[model samples]
Target: MNDISAQAATLQWNDQGLVPAIAQDWQTGEVLMLAWMNREALELTVREGRAIYWSRSRGALWRKGEESGNVQHLKELRIDCDADTVLMKVEQVGDIACHTGRRSCFYQRLENGEWQVTDPVLKDPQTLYGKS
Candidate 1:
């Protein structure tokens, strides 16, 4: 609001008022992962200088490392002109951000109707989640 229209009015958002946010390493530019965010998430990310996400499943707000301690230290945020997507540069601590024990969530590839894990897990989930 507040006449931000001049700065952001063209970005595309989904029907549910959410946008896809991609997280990347600030220095390396390697895509780390992607998450969802609403206006609240975007605001929090900018105001707090930390990664925040909208948990579709949990139906609530979630701050990175709130429970897992695998925090994402935000470095930069890039909003596409369309105002519907965001690119976050962050410093990820710990070995895993995905509950599956992988460093990133995009470790699986669907091939021939079979799910194949494509990346090696950087740490054991149990070590992070305590045998959950």
Candidate 2:
């Protein structure tokens, strides 16, 4: 097997043939998002040097910044000890990783009781996605 395929084979995928992948800022060490990846997605990401995930909702491959111009350039990829999770350090282009136009998908923080919005939206979602 090739290097990319060989790497994918080592991962412990769930029954759905998916593994949880976390994207983090390469320089800042800030976690940007969490997504799922199938074997093909993992191989494509390694070969292309970018972040690509399997979209459960869309039922297809979702390339980061494919529509929003916020591509994540991969810097490094690491697997957990259990080989079940993937951590990708990447240079996030356009400074946005969340579809909500925030820098990260983890925008909520629990305060005394309720969840609060912590990060401000860097760009308007409507503009990013061209929504009406």
Candidate 3:
């Protein structure tokens, strides 16, 4: 087991006591999404082997699979040299991870000097988030 105290001491959380976290597919190495994590979220993620992110809008820690059952199982956790950002390697469950019902959050791209949609939705958002 990694030294918890050492790991905690190394992190550089912002003034709000939050750090940026990037989630990626462990096998494919595809970046899935970006989120913020406070100390509680980070600790919960490590302890539970699941992806947990701090919800800025909700002002709470969100466990990925709690509602949708679209889970992200922790594979590895890496921190940059500065420890201001973290990369979480995860094994994602379900066809989509994005709120837009896409497989990834980075579904847009600049192509041919134009902003273009790169990834089509794998599932319907309405069915997931409900029409609002």
Candidate 4:
């Protein structure tokens, strides 16, 4: 048996010990982004009342908006029927959720079977991240 945190040991984790986490705008019901969460990340998020996720790319726990000022203040956390996915209602600070300086990561739409960018960049990435 895999050792899991007592706080989220009941959650149905995937083979990688991760569960999909979806962040949504609390007021508007807009899904900001989908990230992954491990036991520690989930526990931290719940404990801190903020969005903390496991960064597969970085192979570490990443607090949302740790680099940028756009933090997702957790309002509510809910699990799916299968307990495989976590839905978070959050107050998205800075009004930007997407890394590309958009409001949400889901700014693309499938129009005529082609992916089209539907959202505009509110702030330039260079300015937000202090990089190109």
**Top candidate, metric TM-score:** 2
Model 3 Cα lDDT, one tens digit per residue, 1-132: 333555866799899999999999999999999999998889888888999999999999999866667899999999998989989999999968888889999988998899899899876777776554
The CA lDDT at 29 in model 1 is 80
Over 15-54, each residue of candidate 1 has an lDDT whose tens digit, in order, gives 9978999988787787778899877777777777788999
TM-score for each model = 0.80, 0.96, 0.91, 0.93
Candidate 4 clashing pairs, residues 3+ apart or interchain: none
What TM-score should be assigned to candidate 4?
Answer: 0.93
Q: Candidate 1: what lDDT? A: 0.79
Off by over 4 Å in 3: 2-5, 130-132
- Greater-TM-score candidate between 1 and 3: 3
Name the runs in model 4 displaced over 4 angstroms. Answer: 1-7
**lDDT score for candidate 4 against the true structure:** 0.90
Residue pairs that clash (backbone atoms under 3 angstroms), model 3: none
Order the candidates by TM-score, highest first — what do you get?
2, 4, 3, 1
Please count the clashing residue pairs in each candidate, in the order shown. Answer: 4, 0, 0, 0
